[model samples]
Target: MEQEGEVPHVLIFPFPAQGHVNSMLKLAELLSLSGLRITFLNIHRIHQKLTLHSDILSRFSRFPNFQFRTITDGLTPQNRTLGMFSDLIRRLNSITKPLLTQMLLSGELGPNPTCIILDGLFNFIVDVDAQPKIPVFSFRTISACSFWAYSFVPMLIEDGQLPIKGEEDMDRMIDGVTGMENVLRCRDLPSFCRLKDPSDPALQHGVTQTIQSLKAHSLIFNTFEDLEGPILSCLRRRCPNIYAIGPLHSLLKSRLSGEESSLGSESFNNLWEVDRSCLAETVSQMVNDVMENKRNELMGSVNETAKLAKTSVEEGGSSFRDLERMISDIRFLYRRQREAIH
Candidate 1:
């Protein structure tokens, strides 16, 4: 039960992958900075790797209310590369779900977590029990463009657009995607769209996740409106409550403008080692091209992008306002629960 004047707590569970953890960790830090008590849940395997690579504990230690909790992914010491999500999901249903319930009921994890921010892929876990219930929001650590592309698979299949006939059909233009008709093509769709077999697990994963998102209170994406406005507009028709505040790392980084705010911000934990040499080579070529192309003519747009990230999460700022709304909703839920209990 929440105490008087106590900050409402939020439980964050990422998909246990490098990119997912990196982006969500940044969001966790952002929320902690905003005065919410945060409980970051991690799979032991991924958490182990993250600890080995970076000072995750010491870094998050700055926030007294921030803490890490780990559950087993039920995978071996081996890395999860392919067909691993299936096992992870099975373990979640059998192991983690019950464990989460136990934790919530026992109050062992602190005052009942007011809300759960679950990964979009972990669709099976529903509302947790309390006097009322813990509201769960699904956070997809992917671009709105890719998410919207995956969500269209079922419609494309019904209309005979997916499962391309052959190489000849690869470059064919795709239609009926409400906002992406001009930009999307057969080859441009997610790799899952290329699977001709309906029973294929990878393809099925996309379908299930997209369909299950409707069950959540809100759909959150680490993408900003300027980049995915059209897709977000279409998404809102389905989920209705969608938060697309992203380039999240940059957004959070911009907010920590003080000199001391630089601590641990540089650690972007990557499970897959980044090939900086290839990156450097590509960046060098891009620099030469940009220097010659006079992209300074397009500098206004670049500055606008930077300005958006630097904007505080105030009434008008995209991320600032979305996060404020989230906190407000959770606090309201907490108050209702307290009333019911009393």
Candidate 2:
């Protein structure tokens, strides 16, 4: 437990997938640095992978205000079994939601949790959000374009753009979704949307997550406006309170200290083994290019991404202020709750 007057506490739960965990972990660190107390919840199986493949536990200890908690993912060691994994995900939400609710109501996580930042992918968390006095905000770690594509599943159905007839319809343009008339095709839509059977569970799950996001107090995306401005505009209809502060790697790199943070980021997304061979290949290419007096294509492209990321985090930037605003809102919630209790 923290001291009575500690910074407002937050509980963060990420989907156990490697990519999801990595982005949310960075967001947790950012919130912690901004003077919030953050408790990051990890599933037992994923945490074990971090222990074996990365430095997650040791890396987080340096933050005075951040800590971790774990619960079972309801799966065995092999997360590869899709049928088993899908069943486990359903059980996880039903099982973990109540457990998390119990933890919060007991004040075991801290004095009072002002907010719960959850991965937007889970349907069950919204039910947890209904518990009195605690709010859940969703953080969607997907690109805004993909989210916008997913958001239109219903519209597609209405326009007969979905339930694609066959492979022949795959290449047809989806004219139903406004703002994407020329840009989006059936094949370009999210993979789940490609399923000919509209009743497929996987397809439904993806749709549910996108729709469920609307119920969250706020919806945050790990993308910046310059990159996905049009799709983000479309998303605002469903989620008015949206924040796009991403290329999260850039945001973290800009604000954090040095190598320690970088190293932690390495395993943050690599639940699988990394191909360090890319490094060897790149260095070799650079040497060859220099001898031939030719432009280095890979290095040039990387530098471009780095440049864009850096530009997005400058003073008075979208990501910087949105992060500050999120922390402030949580503190405001904390104060209001305290006064109400008295």
Candidate 3:
């Protein structure tokens, strides 16, 4: 437990996927640096992935303010190989809430957490807040545009456009989704939204559960204004309490000392292990094929446009500003909580 006057504790729960876990971990690192006690929670399977890499384990273990914990994924031990999206909704619903409740009640972790930060994908965490005193914040791990696209799923369905029934129907062009023009097809929406069966119980359960959960808390997207100006505008109008903080890698890099930053190249999450020789040869051939295709596509047609398209979010951009804002908000919340208790 922290000293009485120490910083407030915050619990962070990332979606059980490599990309989402990595992004959320970076945010946790930033919060820890800002003098907050952070408990970073992962599903058991993902925790196994991080533990398998000794380098990653040693690095995180060295941080006193940042700790890691895991809860069961509700999969039988033998069925652990199933991918994250396979039966994900059921597993999360079955396990996370009870596990979190037990953890909060145990009083054995760090100081009691002031708030819970959850992955936007698992909006169910918002509904799990039976304790009115502990605030909840939704953390979005994907691009702002992708988050915006997901917000439209229900509207699209109501208008009789989505839940496309067959493979053939997937290729039909979708019209009138705001800010997105000439989307390739309904099939182009994220994989979860393109289910072939409208009556799929798991699909319906996951979608409805996630959408309903969004109504429970404030939202934070891992993106920035400049990178997604139009989409951010749309989300702001739809959800007022939205925060865009993203490209977390940049914010983390800025906080680390030079020596610590040098170690940042170490891989923190590798769900699959590949033999080096075979992987290298395969990757080289794939890169050559991709380069040849890109050359054909570009063919001297406005090189600047292609350059702009290829820009990264971490080049001191919108994600950077949002990180600053998120850290500030967390600090302010912690201060307010302390003042209330006193």
Candidate 4:
């Protein structure tokens, strides 16, 4: 337990993938800026790749409470690809689970985390140390629609929705997913769900992980209430404690800009170098098409949505307020844990 006045410390463990690490790292930076202590855990290879490719180290160097730690994933870089994801998960459960347990119980990492912001992809295991009762908040890097659809995989299979007969059935409605019945189609389900076999390992693994997400104390999404209101409503029926305080990257900019906090240029933690060569021509052609051919058809809806997005992340917006609530809730947990100990 932390001393009476010590700041709340949060440990962030993102799945060692580019998209997962990128979003969670932004959240980590956001929390550290808000005066919370943060310990970001990464696999050895991802950490090295991040350090070598991005200014991730110097970016968070100003925050004394921010730290980075790593453990082995038991795989070489050549072995870590989309095809080997199942092997990676198995290895993490077998090899990395012990190290994580030790870090929690032995205090080898620093202060015991007031809470853990975990990657939803690794929801297969939630047994962090049981003694102290650490709260875990599952963060899914994907959109709520995508996660909601994944959660219904088992239901879809039981209802004979899987083994989608043929390309002829591609446009068939996917009624199994609650709020998205009208919008979701067989072709729209994730690529893995398109397989001829319903019992495919990857598909089953996805279903298991998504179903296990409900085991977390709460769920966090990288979206805003205004954007996914119906889907969010469906999710709340299952897990009520959810924080939709995103588009995180934009919200972070809004918060920092409002506070007049001058954090340097935006930094990206991509595992591979970004190729910008085609962007110039792409942007010029896009602008030309939008101005000439798409003007009447697209301008109104585009402008309206852009305006909503702007308002959603500004002061008192749904996302901004939810972010404040999330921070407050973490501190509340810290105080409650301390009181229980006393």
| Candidate number with greatest lDDT | 4
Worst 10 residues of 4 by lDDT: 123-132
TM-score of each: 0.85, 0.86, 0.83, 0.91
Candidate lDDT (C-alpha), each: 0.76, 0.76, 0.68, 0.84
Model 2, runs deviating above 4 Å? 1-4, 78-80, 83-85, 126-130, 257-269, 273-279, 282-306
Lowest summed lDDT across 10 adjacent residues in model 2 is found at 261-270
Q: By the TM-score metric, which is better: model 3 or model 4?
A: 4
Tens digit of lDDT per residue, candidate 2, span 186-302? 778766776778888778888888888877888899988767778888888877878888877778777764556454344354566666767887888888767565356767877
At residue 26, what lDDT does model 2 achieve?
85
Model 4, residue 79: what's the lDDT? 90
RMSD, one per candidate, in order: 3.6, 4.1, 3.7, 2.6
- Give the alpha carbon lDDT tens digit for every residue of 162-196 in model 1: 77766766768888877887778877877767777
Backbone clashes for every candidate come to: 1, 0, 0, 0
**Per-residue lDDT tens digits of candidate 3, residues 77-186?**
66655464556566667777667777787875567778788877776644454766777887777666776666667777788877775666767887767887676377
By TM-score, how accurate is candidate 1? 0.85
- Residue 280's C-alpha lDDT in candidate 3? 78
Cand. 3 Cα-lDDT: 0.68
Deviation of model 2 at 49, angstroms: 1.2
- Candidate 3 positional error at 75, Å: 1.7
